[model samples]
Target: MIEPASITNVMRALADPTRRAVYERIASSDEITVVELTRGSGVTQGAISQHLKSLKQAGLVAERPEGRNVYYRAEPEGLTPLVDWMSHYGVFWRERFTNLRTLLKEIDP
Candidate 1:
């Protein structure tokens, strides 16, 4: 049972290099303005805005409107779908390892 939309959103939003860099910058800070997001990234403010828009659509980023400025930050909980998908495999592997251990004990004893 895979969440197609969830995975699609994350993958599509992260597929761009500039967007990925901006995401890292946003995640490293508590909150950042669009102006600050591209300070050292060599990208234009408008481009950053576009990237932020895409990220927001993916639920990977959150925005805070303050007067005339809008702040952005990473939304860690937004990654739940992806994490949950991976965790499904974690349980499978754990069970396999446990069975292997039991088999080894039976062979030795």
Candidate 2:
């Protein structure tokens, strides 16, 4: 079963466009630092850090400290709650689509 709180947290964390973009960058890279994420992002380093903090809180990203730079990477398992919540509604949508297809076939023939 998916926990509502976790789903909410993941959704809330990704709801912001800027934050979502930040997450995407992290997900695409094997590991990246705040300076790398800030480059060409049009946001300040502090803003990126803030976004990273939210992602970390949501379990969306994990960080490793090496030397003076901290590398951030995507946590694929963190999306389980959100994925489960969406999958729960998959049956409903599939049934609806099947009904629509039947109706379309009847109308066409």
Candidate 3:
């Protein structure tokens, strides 16, 4: 039931450290523009735009064009696939930990 494609896209889009940083900034901000992202980032505006494109393709960010600037904001729902995948494995780990806890208690008792 996990969406491999969506997870892959999200992972790939975030694999780049710069891109991940860009995503983080967008996530923390109410909204931002490419120029704002590029400033003090040491990356060119074009590069920031490209990163935004990748984020958009992964459904990680949404954009709204206003006047001469396009503002971007993080899309929280974009992480659903990744969250679902992790939750699926989280159950497995939780069960293992519980078993280990019980075993340790029995040995101590």
**Minimal lDDT window, size 10, model 3:** 79-88
lDDT of 1 by residue, 50-89 (tens): 9999999999999999999999989998777778878899
lDDT (C-alpha) at residue 32 in model 1: 98
lDDT of 2 at 43: 100
Per-residue error for 64 in candidate 2, Å, reads: 0.1
Each candidate's lDDT (Cα)?
0.91, 0.97, 0.96
* Candidate 3's TM-score: 0.90
Per-residue lDDT, model 2, residue 86, is 88
**lDDT for position 44 in model 1:** 92
Best-fitting candidate, scored by lDDT: 2
Q: How well is each residue in 62-89 modelled by candidate 3, as lDDT tens digits?
A: 9999999999999999988889989989
Q: What is candidate 3's local distance difference test score?
A: 0.96
Name the runs in model 3 displaced over 4 angstroms: 104-109
Instruction: Put down candidate 2 lDDT per residue, 1-109, tens digits, no spaces.
Output: 7788999999999999999999999999999999999999999999999999999999999999999999999999989998898898997799999999999999997
Judged by whole-model lDDT over C-alpha atoms, candidate 1 comes out at 0.91
TM-score of 2: 0.88
Higher-ranked by TM-score: 2 or 3: 3
Number of clashes in every candidate structure? Answer: 0, 0, 0
